[model samples]
Target: MPAKAGAVTMQQVAECAGVSMMTVSRVLNDDARVRESTRIKVMRAVAALGYRPNISARSLAGARSYLLGLLYANPSAAYISELLIGALKSCRAAGYHLVVESCDMEEAAIGEQMLALAKESRLDGLILPPPLCESAPLMAALEAARIPYVRIAPFTRLDAAPYVCIDDAAAARDITARLIALGHRRIGFIKGHPNQGASRLRLQGFQDAMQAAGLRSARRDICQGYFSYKSGLRCAEKLLNRADRPTAIFASNDDMAAAVYAVAHRHGLDIPQDLSVVGFDDTLIATTLWPPLTTVRQPIAAIAGAAVELLTTNRRAAAVLRQPAAPRRLLDYAIVERQSTAPPTTPD
Candidate 1:
């Protein structure tokens, strides 16, 4: 009979599968040399027995710590939550543990914090999400310490390390062109945090769309934001308070777009009627709003999962080659059209 859950051992699993404990260990460690049939049989026995390996025991017996770390400094709760879910899922599948560390300190202090975390945790590898991914200090520190890492949506240093991202510029351009197709000649734009590289690419896309349509995007209509609800509130107020207010506004993120909804309601304006609002990063806030937000769907969870895969794959490759690898992955993005956009009431 199978052992009780949480009490199952590798020896029991091997006995159940008619395999040696060494074979079970190799399967659990994801050794590629294990035959397909044997791996499947071992996994079946593991599942049937509800076997949970003791990470500490496994580490003591092997060279690997079986620990991965995720370092982030982004302010979007939705983004971070999705990232965690994805990374955790991937880690579990790979028989690894995930340690999440938040770095909200200044740039000068970020490197030190990350290095300390690495040493303390004895992490096998790390995954970085923006704006930490774009931090030069953090990159230098990681390289100096020879810590394997993968980046999600890094703006600068594309060739510096492995990364996963969508074409931010193209996604921004497509969404902006969408507003134009709705006959919105005067559209407003809210830029994301200046610290991130994606912010610049997105802004460029918005500008490219407007210029292509032969529409003059006024300086006053383009406001700077930090990809936060508070920054969105400030930018929305600036644009909505103007006499020549834009008929539509596109924020760099959903949080800022949600802020626009609040400001529009305060000004006694109806969404998509008096003002049209759109955002990027089709996060939870996008659908929860009164009129669902029209935004660019950047697959946050998928990106995180891919980041973890890259790090694990790199670790395997380095074990044999004794050198790190840098690979880049570009995912796809989509423009989700909801009830939040409409043509301007009056022609430009």
Candidate 2:
């Protein structure tokens, strides 16, 4: 007899489908080796019986913790929130739990802290988001401990582990080129955090576009930012306060671009009329501003989800192959043009 809807177990589903419990498990885990006909039968039985696998029982049986860790040090709330949503959704789909840790420790202490956290949490794998993704000490500790990890937008050591990211340089270059095509010669650029690999790539793209246009970016036109609104404000002040202010400004992220908006308002400059502005990372802040920001959309949530998938997939492959190859994925990005950019009133 089939168990009650909420009480149906994997064993009951297997019996109902006339398949072994192992077949049911493989089907549930989305193992590619499962025959399509067998998979369909198992799924139909699962639906008919309302079977739900017991995660704890499955973990104990497989000698797996069924837990993943996400370590991050990024300061942007919008970015972090999107990342959490994606990771959590993927975890739920995979029947795994996520342990998120915020690393505020100094560089010297980060490795030790991560090592201790991994031991205490017994994480099956880890997901690293920028800045943290580029940490050598943390990577070294994880490698030494034989813990698997997936990185999102890592700056260096591309072959060290699996990773997922968009082409930051190409996206940055496209947006910068858009500003140039708008008849703006004197364009200001605000760089993202120096610690992030994307920052350097984005800056390089901006410079590349400027040079391609036969325009030279003055030293004063490029300001350093830490991917924070506060930093954006400071950079904006410096750029806008100058006697020869740029007709347009391109900030590396939406947060910084929003800061540019605030500073522009304070200086009594009308957007796209007095000064045009653009930003990257089409986070919520991009639309919340008065004149919606023209920015690059990097699919933050999708990237996070892909990172989780990569970690889970690699773990499964390693169990059988002992040494699965690390894969690097580059997702696509789009330039979302909104109300924030326009042709300069007077060509520079």
What ranges in model 2 sit over 4 Å off?
A: 1-8, 15-18, 26-51, 319-324
lDDT of 1: 0.88
Residue pairs with backbone atoms closer than 3 Å in model 1 (clashes): none
Off by more than 4 A, model 1: 1-20, 30-51, 105-107, 319-325
For every candidate in turn, the CA RMSD to the true structure comes to 3.0, 3.1
What tens-digit string does per-residue lDDT give for candidate 1 at 1-348?
A: 656656988898999999999999988776777898998999999888878788889899887788999988888899899999999998886668999988874856888789889988998888889888888788778888888888888777555588899999999999999999989998999999998889999999999999999987788989999989999999999999999899999999999999999999999999989899999999999999989999999999989999888877655335311244467789999999899999888887
The Cα local distance difference test for each model comes to 0.88, 0.87
Alpha-carbon TM-score of each model against the true structure: 0.89, 0.91
Q: Model 1 reaches what TM-score against the true structure?
A: 0.89
| Model 2, TM vs. native | 0.91
